[model samples]
Target: MSSYPTPTLATARLVLRPLVATDAEALFAVFSDPAVVRYWSAEPWTSVAFAEQAIARALDSYRAQSEVRFGIVLADTGALVGTVNLHHFFAQNRRCEIGYALASGHWGRGYASEALEAAIGYAFQGLDLNRIEADIDPRNGASAAVLERLGFRKEGYMPERWFVHGEMADTVNYGLLRRYWNERP
Candidate 1:
């Protein structure tokens, strides 16, 4: 696999940058909320320590060339609203997966869409990735709509791909190709 760089990216109203140690408190506020993490693959974080640990791991993974995650910060308030992640890279195939968790308060406001669109652009144009994929909970209509608007087509559904919160959860897989993305309206 090729080592890719994680550089800062800016959208109209948000900034996609690396998470820092100082962001722990704000990160905890977002990840520890049950509502924010309700549909996420991981359980709601219990403490600020979780955020600290996650940031550290994210940085380490970046150095290890395995995964990369960006902290979603509102440009105006300079608040850490959530994260946009692009990981599970396959350099040979030019494919990767994207995931995110925005603060519940920021949902319905297009922050996730803006950040994701920027990230997708970087994945394709910057890293030269040909394909980007997302595995979301089928129940998440909001995420489904976002993916659709971004030109990702729902290609498959897995009945029990993840065991979350003591239950078998389904996954809706979405994909977008470079050629299609380049021609997106």
Candidate 2:
């Protein structure tokens, strides 16, 4: 039996579930796009091996019950779109961090927002978590906007927190409390 069978989260158009080895190709397609990863903490993946390694790590984390990463897919065609993750678990405090990515081809649509909603709902309800946090490059306006739309408030800013690909970037922190999420209109 699986240590943590990642529950499937579905909306009208998307399905979020645990990634399998077979998803490596689609996963590589999403992360290998420069446009999709421009503001990401890591640079674009160079090979399918990166996706394979990531799935390997995700599987290990799942078995250890340390992190939950969900692959976002289109419901109609079951095509991989992106991913949403809840990691850095502080079980004693009932808290974790949220992160997500989407293919550039799916940009301008509400896929990220929809997928995040499902993931956040799972974190708070299914996992019984109290707080979820996120830190993103301030230049990622779209990501900040999505977190805001999901009721995550900007909490702090850290300058030059990351030096990825020889570029220094500032981070804006966001946090959402379960009570606040419960109170959303």
Candidate 3:
């Protein structure tokens, strides 16, 4: 896949940038909350070590040009609220998967959508990707709605796709094409 520098993206209320080591504490605070990771494939983080390790991995991935994970922050307060990432790249197909998580307290405020929109824009314009995909637990209606609002269509479903924390979860797949996004209002 093509590698591009992680640019700082801005929206009306949020900023999307690469993760930093100093963000460990704030990252821990967001990921440790069970409510924030209810639909995630992994359990709630129990330690700051996880955040530090994750930051290290992100740095490695950035260097390898394999994935780009942005730490979503409030533009005004400069507080880290969550993360949105474009990963699982398919260079031959010009495609990748989009994923994100936000603190529960920040929900209902459109932060996730704002950050995701910026990421998707970058993927299409900066990386020259043609398609982006999302996989969500079927029960995550809020996430599904966000994808739909961004012009991603429900493409397929897979039963028992993930075994997370002893639960066999179904996945609802969504996809957005460059043409579709370009036509979006």
> lDDT per residue, candidate 2, 102-164, as tens digits?
999999899999999999998888888899999999888999999999999999999999886
Sorted by TM-score (best first), the order is 3, 1, 2
Off by over 4 Å in 2: 1-5
TM-scores, all models, native as reference: 0.96, 0.96, 0.97
Winner on TM-score (1 vs 3): 3
Which runs of model 1 end up more than 4 angstroms from their true locations? Answer: none
Q: How many pairs collide in each candidate, listed in order?
A: 0, 0, 0
Q: What does candidate 3's lDDT look like per residue over 80-164, in tens digits?
A: 9999989988989999999899988899999999999999999999999999999999898999999999999999999999997
Instruction: Give candidate 2's whole-model lDDT.
Output: 0.91
Better by lDDT, candidate 2 or 1: 2
Candidate lDDT values, in order = 0.90, 0.91, 0.93
Q: List the residue pairs that clash in candidate 2.
A: none
Which candidate leads in lDDT?
A: 3
The TM-score measured for candidate 1 stands at 0.96
